[model samples]
Target: MILTLLDRLNRRRAWLRWGLLAAGLLVAFGLPWTLYPPVATDIVCWGLFAVAFDLLLGHAGLLSFGHAAFWGTSAYGTGLIAIHSGVPFYVAVLGGTAAAAMLALPIGYLAVRRSGIYFAMITLAFAQMVYFVTNQWRDVTGGENGLQGIPRTLPGFDLSNSFVFYYAALPVVLLGLLAAWRIVHSPFGRVLAAARENPARVRALGYPADHYKLVIFVISAFLAGLAGGLYAVNHGFASLQEVYWTTSGKVAMMTILGGIGTLWGSLVGAAAIVRLEDWLATAGFEATGLVTGVIFIAVVLIFRRGIWGTITHLLRARAVAPVPQIEPHLEHDHDELQPTPTN
Candidate 1:
């Protein structure tokens, strides 16, 4: 009976999962019509960026403060390719993403050797180095002004239209989300999670924990790069701010506000933060950061699990919670059958 109950519960959870995914996709598809296409595009780009950060911080227990290095690098790489080489949109994006991954390779190798705050600091230092390089290479990077006049020319599609661009970006963002989902659900992801929980144990069990960390770090950087590449095309510019430390901080906030380990929650957080900032700007509030800070504080204090995380917790508790138990009676029933002693 217990096994039967468990099976039914599992099936119900599966249905719920599919239903939620369908609803989410529906909202995503319909959002451009409801809101400005440009705004929606920003949400998608930032959402992907946040999700990439979460893969390292949430699942792998690695907190990186230099994620913007990957993001900005890819943005510049894509923008430059689009401007100078005149490559196809897809090729430019791929080249940018590949560059980010390559940059991550050596950095991740060194960063993974350390853990905790040391790891984060190492990444941040490297990111600062990258920032300095980009800032000084004025001839190539456009320095403070940034790369401009980037053409959004996807093959066979007129991407100058905001509506058309939004649709074009949608599939790429969805694929990034899908890739994240697959990573978290796969056996490698399980091992990664195990490593996160207890690296010493994972190491003792013949697994190289550092190797796993480095691999995941590279993958996360690649996704961030992909988002950055898309953003460059979407905005027709790649700015130094994209690689700045503040951008990394903003993505960290998005990941935390959305619910750390919940991948989709990153999107929710991104939407909340992006819309909040836009609303604040529209309202002529110069102290936008103060209001955003207050909201972050409230979320951290009131909903410790974050917006979507709290909702998920409630749903799970309601769905599979056990019934209340009764206390055992002290006295035995006289009519109950007793077994005879064996010879």
Candidate 2:
């Protein structure tokens, strides 16, 4: 009886998840109509960033303090490529993602050797180096001023308009999200889960745990770079602030606030944070960081599992609760009602 009840609950939970996904799709497609086009675009870009960070922090069990290196580098690369090469916007974004992967190779090679805080420190250190390089390379990067007038174009269409560009660029973001989902559901993803839980056991099973870690790190950087490139194009500039440590920290906050291991949760977290910042800015609140930090602290202390995680936990708990046991005679009556087979 317990097994049967669990099975039914499991089915119900699956249906609920599917329903949520459908609703989420509807929201994604309709958001631009309700919100400012630029804000809607920013939400999607930040959502991608959060999802990328979660892949590394949540699934790979690695904490990085310097993902801004990937994001910032990609932003600069995208702007430079478009300014000089005059390639299509999507092509430039791809170029930027590719460059981020290359940058990740050496960083991941070194960072994966350490775990815990050491790993984070190494990434942070490398990110600082990248920031220095970016600041000094004024000829290309535009130093403190940043690169402005980066074009967003498709041969025939005028994508300079924010509204037109948001829809055009959205499909690429969706494809990136789909790629993440596929990776998480793949066999390699199982190995990542095992490594997250028990690295020693993964090595005992003959898997080169270091290789897997490096691969996922690069993959995460690629996704982040993709987001950064798109962001620069959408805004028509690449700013130095994109490479700042706070940007990396912000994405981490979004991932944690949304439920780190849940990809959709990352999007939810992004929307919440982005919208809050937007609202604060519009209201002329100067201490945006203070307000955001206070709310983040409150959420962490109250909903330790994060918004999505806590909600799902409550649902599962209710599902597993014993239904009032059927009356004892009800079972007996059901057996009596069953027709006996003739021998």
Candidate 3:
């Protein structure tokens, strides 16, 4: 009876986790219709971008400082396609994401060979190379000025309206989030996590650690590129600033602020930082960098695990009810077993 009861309790816990996740998704879907719709939509975009960063940094234990390469490349690619081809917005976005992934394959292959700070430096250097290319290739790239007048269309849907655009972007963002969640929960994710924890041990088990890392790097790049494409459409332009190293560093800070390994935490951190910066700027704060830096330091010092981690920890602690001790027992047929015991 006790075993049966324990089994049921475990099942209930699993169901509850799924239930909470569904509720969170529903909230995200409804957010754009609520107050501050534009801000909410922007939050969704940055959230998706941050999740991509977390995928490589947190899940794969790969620190990339040149992720802006993917982000900016996708934005520019999508913007150019939108401007020149008059293609459907979604198709353009996909093209952008594919371009970013293709770029990641060669770059990530070389960068993934080096771990720690060297890995980060390789990514940074590669990003700088990309930036320089965009700047020097003035005729094609528009140099420092960036690509302007990018089309913001939703195909059959009339996306000239803000609400229409918000709804359109919301579904894509949700799909991206779902994909990220699925990837992180699969067997691939387990192997990736194992690789991160101990690459030597994982290789000893015959798993190709480098291959897994490269795959994840490409995946992360693809998603970041998707977000960048969406960003271009949302703003109706693609800028060189999108590919800057500072932008990459800001993403790293956002991910760390929200909870390095927690996917949702990255989103939360991005939203918080963006909103806070917006508010501060409106309040005559010219030195936003100084304020943000101080806050980042404070967050790192106090909430090292980030808001989601802290919330989860608190909730779990609150749920720590006393567990009842169980003792084992056996029942036997007295007549048959008693004779054996006596013997």
Q: Pick the candidate with the highest TM-score.
A: 1
- Pairs that collide in candidate 2 are none
lDDT against true structure, model 1: 0.91
lDDT of 2: 0.91
Show the lowest summed lDDT stretch of 10 residues, model 3.
324-333
Tens-digit per-residue lDDT, 242-284, candidate 1: 9899889889999999999998999999999988898888889
Q: What is the lDDT of residue 286 in candidate 3?
A: 95
Residue 280, candidate 3: Cα error in Å is 2.0
Write down the TM-score for model 3: 0.89
Positional deviation of 83 in candidate 3, in angstroms?
0.5
Q: Tens-digit lDDT track for model 2 on 171-199?
A: 98898899898899999999999999999
Candidate 1 regions exceeding 4 Å error are 323-343
Assess every candidate by TM-score: 0.93, 0.92, 0.89
Give RMSD to native, each candidate. Answer: 6.8, 8.2, 7.9
| Model 3 accuracy (lDDT, Cα) | 0.86
Model 2: how far residue 129 lies from native, Å: 0.8
| Candidate 2 positional error at 341, Å | 51
